[model samples]
Target: MITLKNVTLRRSAKVLLDNASVTLNPGEKVGLVGRNGAGKSSLFALLNGTLHEDGGDYYIPAQWRMGQVAQEMPETDQSATDFVVEGDTTLVAAQAEVRAAEATDDFERMAHAYMELHDAGAHDAPARAQALILGLGFKTTELTNPVNSFSGGWRMRLQLARALMCPSDLLLLDEPTNHLDLDALVWLEAWLKRYEGTLVVISHDREFLDAVTNVTLHIDAGKLVRYGGNYSKFEDMRAEQMELQQAAFGKQQDKIAHLQKFIDRFKAKASKAKQAQSRVKALERMEKIAPMLADADFSFEFKEPANLPNPMLSMSGASFGYPPPEDAPAGTPPTVIVQHVNRSVLAGQRIGILGANGQGKSTLVKTVARALAPIGGELTEGKGLNIGYFAQQELDVLRPLDTPLEHMIRLVRETAARGQNHGQGTREQDLRSFLGMFNFGGDMVKQAVGSMSGGEKARLVLCMIVWQRPNLLLLDEPTNHLDLATREALSMALNEFEGTVMLVSHDRALLRAVCDEFWLVTRGGVEPFDGDLDDYQRYLLDEAKRQRESLKESLKEPVAATTKIAESEAPKGATGTFSLKNAPAQRKLDAQRRQQHADKARPIKRELEGCERRMAELTQEKARIEAQLATPLAPAAIAETGKRLKAVGDELHALEERWLELTEEIEHTAGA
Candidate 1:
């Protein structure tokens, strides 16, 4: 258990935490959330003791052990598995000493070392390390792989696994799900839910927070508020609070305005002058309730540029892959990643490109946006088709010397140079309003792009794109660093946006909420599933069931068919005696057929194994959804669940398709 007692944190004269008090009890899962630069991560640092508060009382049980997962991996010479195993350093060192003593055959040293190691539970270290490694998705063989060989993402997982393995009184995680795939994320969520230790995590993952956390710690406007229940329940309560605040602020403003009017009209009369002066004083003293953070009058409308009828972009027979060049040597062959992608991007259709991380979803978007040339396809452009493309790595393109405002001005000037300065004032106001929406205010707008956080830079880049108002918005991974509130606002805005939009995102909830249809990029091709996320999910469940049945049937096929063939091929010999020499040709044919059947069975067996894994994964997803549904449903939570279900369904359908193909092949081969 850890506690923050009226903690006050300040940096460069800005208050990060002002008299903020919070508590983390045993088994408490708290999600820290706020807008960008709202000190969410800073609070975690303060609690973890890496960053001390200016004035505060941070308390934890004296005997409690603490673990914090660093955003970046720490420098070490050990392999990935070794690093994770080293989490229990004391035990590891003792165990090593014991091993050395045993190797040297020093009876006295070995006896002392063995007792010390056993007392420290060093003997169980290897098993614990193995369990953690597997739980974090590392194969047993990968245990000895060099840590440096892994990517930053995998290193993060390693850090997470290491932390989880070392049992602590409390665990502090900052954006733990940032690098996790759905499977790992689900595993983590389940782990945290069942973990007995206290947990304080700073995450923007709504579904994650909703599933694991019992309380929400919200830091907004230099204030920390704790709400009972998960993220969704907290949001609902906050919405209610906002409504009340808005009403009270409105009434107070009206009262003050009326008082001002009365004072202005009756000030000339000596009798009323004293009363008017008092009323003015009262009005001045009245702390006019601050208005809720909502759209200001200066906020400009984001209207898509006008275009001719029909879709802005269309693709026929569009194929994409990272195949080797035709000029390559004769021994090499190219891989076809996606083929026969026939899709039409209509004027108002919102499409979502869904697939695994490396499945060319982004490539498809780039091809449609003309950022990349398609491998082989017929892509047609509609009249007046203007596209605003937002790449996942777009922030890297920002000029380091330029401030956020300067970036906007540069974009505006480009539009002017192109003779398209239709609404400069509207654009400028819109730019500022958009910046504010992303938590970048006056001073922040003036800050150099290089000085801003990754999230800030990303938000600024997105805001600039929206200012151009292109009819077709091609966004890849748009919600990467955005907070929950900002993501929701953007999702809602895009939903209301009157334009053709195609986005490649791993954020399932955002896709389901904002897009009208979904496309899956796979090894064979870009397949369009005809439905919303919910429909896709139902299809997954059905497909999963079908695959299980098919796998069962496949396993039974070889034995049953072989037995029947043996019975039918029973030798009939003259004099009621079977002669092996005479039936040699038939026997050879049967032997060849059996070999063929065996060959076919091998691939089918492999396919069946894959199908089983897929089914298991889907079942886990259904369990997650059922868990979430059992809890309260906020709009965001509902959207999150819907998207997860859709993903599960998509995966199931893919497995089922593979199962059918394999089963058909098996049947054909067995018949011969």
Candidate 2:
């Protein structure tokens, strides 16, 4: 267990935690959450021993090993697998000792070193490291690639894999899912679930917190508060506490008001002057209860599009991929990823693009966004179509040296150049105000984009996107850097949006909240996915299992072939076991078994489809109720509506769980 008692921490002159205390038990998974710069990272630094508390006691077991993702990009030429294997210092040391003992011809030392290596699992370290790397979205062929060859984001993934490879009692991960795709994020969630260690993770992804964390440690107002459950439960508990606090504050205000009235009425009279003075003293003596501070409420809406064109875009036999390499032969063709992708994006459609990393989800998005052209086929945009594309890489759209105000100014100028506007001229003051809506105000608007945090940059990009008032939004990982508040704000805006949205995000909460349907990009093709995020997850797991089985079969083929040749070379009378000739029959039987399993799952699939349809209806109804609740109504009407909303919400939640269970059942039946 680790404990911090009366810990006072400060950075320079700014106090982050004032006598804060919290305890984390061993093997506990805690989510560290707060607004940016609320000292979440500072507290992490304190735990990692990089920073000391100004005044308090901190305790952790002395011998326990701690592991954390390295922030610095590795700049080495070492193979990726070797770099990950180096995370296990004990194994590396044991291997080194074994090498030294062998070189010196010391039999006793060599024996001891070999035993140490065995205990440390040194022989299997490469395979374990490879597994971690693969789980983090690295290709198997890239295992032998040089570390320095990877880009910054991939290097960060390598760092995460290295941290996971480390044998530690305490693991610290700060936004580990930031650079990962949905497939990798799902894999990481499962890996963390099985991790037998204490985990402290800082993440803005709410679904991730709910899936992996059992405790939530919130930093607010320079104070540390520990909640007993995950992020959702923490929110509920916090809301209840705020409600009680608000009640106490209201009571305190009422008492103060009555006392003030009595004092005003009596203080002027000589007979009751003493009594009035007593009242004044009592008022002064009473301890004031502060009103509960609400979380920052950020709400913004995209301006109605100038045109709502049905079928915003259509592709015919479109091939989406990168352009041909500069050094390629003169007639070389562009490398196509997704081919024969004939699809129509309709107005008001919310489509989530799903795929593994490097599987061309981004490619499809780019093609639709017109950042990249279709290589072999035509992509037709509707008349008056305007696209607001948010790239996964912030820097791809944002200028580093420019300030927020400057970025907005450029956007307005570009809009004016394109002769598209709301008739009101874009003024400098208006641009500043627009930036302010995204939380950029005062000096923040003037701050260089290069110096801004990832969340800030993302917000700037969003602000620019919304300013365009495009009819269709092509968002690729738009919430990657947003905090919970900003994400909620975006979700609300998207929900209220009348335009179409095509989103590719690893944030499951955002996807579930915004996307009405999903498109799966895989194996050089794109098609509609007839399921939700839960179903997609199950598909990924099933696909991984299939790949493992395929690899095993491939590995056995050569041995089987060698055995067949040997049997043929044997005497005719020799005992011939069930031969390779039966392999085709076995495969046929396996296919039959698969077909049987599918037949068994047919009813369950039908039930899941019904559940999904009901869920959609209930979701829309709940949204309608919520919108009604937000309006001004009589107290009785409001109460009735609120009760109905709660009932609907409960039913919706139950249906969602049922949908997940049904998906799992179908998956299990199929796999079996």
Candidate 3:
């Protein structure tokens, strides 16, 4: 167990933790959550003994080993596998001792060294390291590649793998999922589930926290607060606490108001002078309750477009990827990721784009946003279309040396230059006010973007996007650098926006809150996902299992073939050949079997199609009813519509279940 009693921690002259205390028991998985710069990292530092409390006591068992991901970017030519394997320092030391003992020709020392190596499990270290690498999304072929050959994000994965490879009693991971794709994130979640050691992870992803954590450690207002259960439970408990606190504060304020009113009414009268003085004394002595501070200081909305085009954009027979080389031969074709995609973006549509990394989610967004041209076919924009695009890489659009004010001003000038406002000028003061709306006020507006934190830079990018008054938004991983509060604020703003949104994000909460539909990009095709996030999760798990089974089958092919040959050569009737006399009968029997299966499946297939059509109709009706509810409607009409919508939803659910059953039945019959 680890305990911090009255711990007051500070960096420079600023206090991060003020008399805050929390205890962590053995084998507990804790999620440390707070705003950016709220001392979550500082707490990790204290736990690792790199930083100490400014006051009071902090204790950890001396025998316990700790492992944490390194923050510095690695620059090494060493093979990736070797680098991760080196994380097992005990194993490395034991191997070194064995070598030394052998060089000295000391039999007794060599025997002890061999036993130490066995205890450290040095023999299987390579396999363990490789497994960690694979789980972190590296291919088997890349295991022996030089670490320096990989990109920064891949290197960060290596760092995470290295941390995981270490043998320790406690493991600390900070923002471990930031550089990971959904596949890797899912794998990491499973890996963390099987881990036996005590774990503390800092993450802004709520779904991830709920999946992996048994406890929540929330740092707020310079206090370390511990809550049982996961992030969702913590949210529930916090909301209830806030409700009680607000009620008490309201009651206290009423009492103070009553006392003040009495004092003001009769303080000048001689009979009430003593009482008024006593009231003033009492007021002075009474403790004040501070107003509750909101979780986020910022909120923003997309400016409504002047025109709402029915079809905001359309892609017909389009291929998304980079342009071909100009100097290539005439027959050289453009490299495409997703080909022959036909999609339409309608007014007020909220579409979430999902895929594994490098599967063209960003490519599709870039092509639609006109940051990259379509490799083939046409992408037509509706008349009066205005697009707002948020890139996943903040630095790609942000000039590091420029301030937030400069970025907004440039946007205004660009809009004017493009004749977007018909030569209407945008003033610097207006830009400053717009920036201030994003929490970039006072001197902060003039602060250089290079000096700003990742969250600040991300906010600046978003502020610029919102200022464009675009009806269609293309966002790629917009929540990457945002804190939980900012993410909540963004989610709220997205929900309220009237514009069409096409977002690519790993944040499940954002997707669930904002997206009306989901599109899947995989295997050179883009198609609609018929279900929700839960369905998508199950699909990923099933896909992973299938891939593993395929690999196993491929590995067994040679041995299985050798066994078949042996059986064929040794045993009578082990293998049979079709005789000419029976060939006609066998063909007739095969045709009968095929016809029987087709007869069994044809009605199911037809019913499945019918169910799909009905499901689509119900979905559209539900959306229409929701839109009506959002408008000004009579209370009776609203109630009636709500009931109808519920009925439609229930029917849709039943239809979906039937559809799944039909699909499975058809597939099973065909395979048979």
Candidate 4:
């Protein structure tokens, strides 16, 4: 158990936590969430003993061993496996004991030391380390590569592998998924779900938190709050708390009402109903969790484009990749990551790009963004196709020495030079005001882009994108540095934008909220992915299994196929059905069967949606009645309103129960 009693924590003169008391039990997987700079990292420091409490007591069980990813990048020339194996302090201590025992010529001590080494799994340390490394997205061939040969992101992955290699009763991970792609992120989630220790993590990813965390801890205004469930549950709880605070909740009420009006007026007139549904759904969610999200420091939107291109882009027999080295022989070929990509980008389409790392997700985006040319074949763009490209690396698009004001001014000048009238202000004062809309006010507009945080840089990129009013947006990992509030704001803004979007991101919450369809770039081609994110995750896991098995086959000597099945491949459940988790053929059943299940789920889903809409209506009516009751009213009117409130509550409860039942039925049908 870890306990903080009346703990006061401070960094310099700023108090992060004051008189905060909390208890963290063993074997709890907890997600710690807060706004950026609200002391989430400081709290991690407190737990790791890097910083002590300024007052009161903080205690952990003396026998508990803690494991955490190293913050500093490794500059060593050691092989990746060896470096990770060194992270196991227990094994290192045991080996050291054996050396000491041999030096002293003590037979008893030497035997004890050898036994300790064996118990620590010293003989299989390399294998264990390699598994961790590969699961974090390293190639098997690269296991023995010198650690210094990798880039900063890959090096940070090695550091995470090292942390996972260590045996401990408690593990702390901070933004572990920031460097990971979807493939590696899925693997890490599975690994953490099986972890036997108490796990605490800090992340802005809502889907990641929902998948891996059972408990949530929140830091708000120097107070530590603990919730009984995951991030979604915490949001629900917090929404309820805000609703109870009438003075605060009143401020955002009119804005929500205006949103409801917009939804009602525009849902029927929606040009693309499939795409516009995202907005209606998003607005419904916002109404439920209002005011809290309304508190974000940064909120802005993309201006509607001056013109819309029906077919924004078209590519035929295209090969997207980097050109050959200039020093290479004249006949040398270019590097083509994705070939034969025959696709068209349609106006109003919101597409999510899905693939493993190094599978050309970014390469395709770069090609479309005009950062690279097709190795072969043709790409055609529609007339008036204004492009706004946001690269994965902010530095790629930003001049380190330039200020925000300078960047905007240059954009204004470029637009003017091109003879365009996209409604951007031409004057210096106007550009400064535009920058202020993105939180770059006063001196911030003059601050060097190099001196800002990653989030600030991302905001600047978004600000630039909005200024151009592009009809087509090519964004790669755009939310990498944005906080939760900012992410929500972005999601809402995307829903409201009247333009085409092509996004590549590991943030599932953003993907699910924004994309109506998905494109999968895999192997050497691109195709439409005929599934949702949950289906894609299962596919990724199956793909990883196939990779692992292929690697195993390559390593072993030729032998009979009579080898025993691996434990993970064994039969599952009391029914003795063979493991379908890694069996692609078994899991890929006939379309007829899938359609039958979908048929069964359809009516239940319709019922559920009906109930949900009715519940929303009842909830809003209840709030309205409550607001009326809070004011001066005639006795008869008050009694009538109170009676209607009770009626609405009763119906809401009944419908809610039915909604739960329908949800369970549909899930069972799908699983069947």
By TM-score, the best candidate is 4
Q: lDDT, candidate 2, residue 528?
A: 88
Question: Model 3, residue 157: what's the lDDT?
Answer: 96
Model 3 segments more than 4 A misplaced: 247-295, 324-333, 422-425, 558-672
- Measured by lDDT, the strongest candidate is 4
- In order of appearance, the predictions have TM-scores of 0.67, 0.76, 0.76, 0.80
Better of 3 and 4 by TM-score: 4
For candidate 3, report its TM-score. 0.76
Candidate 2, residues 493-549, lDDT tens digits: the string is 775578999999998777765676788999899998877777788999999999777
Write candidate 4's Cα lDDT for 197-288 as tens digits. Answer: 99999988998999999999999888889999999889989989988888977887776665555446545554454434554465566666
What local lDDT score does residue 610 receive in model 2, on the 0 to 100 scale? 86
**Per-prediction tally of clashes:** 1, 0, 0, 0
Error of 2 at 109 (Å): 5.3
The worst-scoring run of ten residues by lDDT in candidate 1 lies at 289-298
Flag clash pairs in model 3: none
Candidate 3: minimum summed lDDT over ten consecutive residues — where?
A: 284-293
TM-score, predicted candidate 4 vs. hidden true structure? 0.80
Candidates 1 and 3 compared: the better one by lDDT is 3
Candidate 1 TM-score, true structure as reference: 0.67
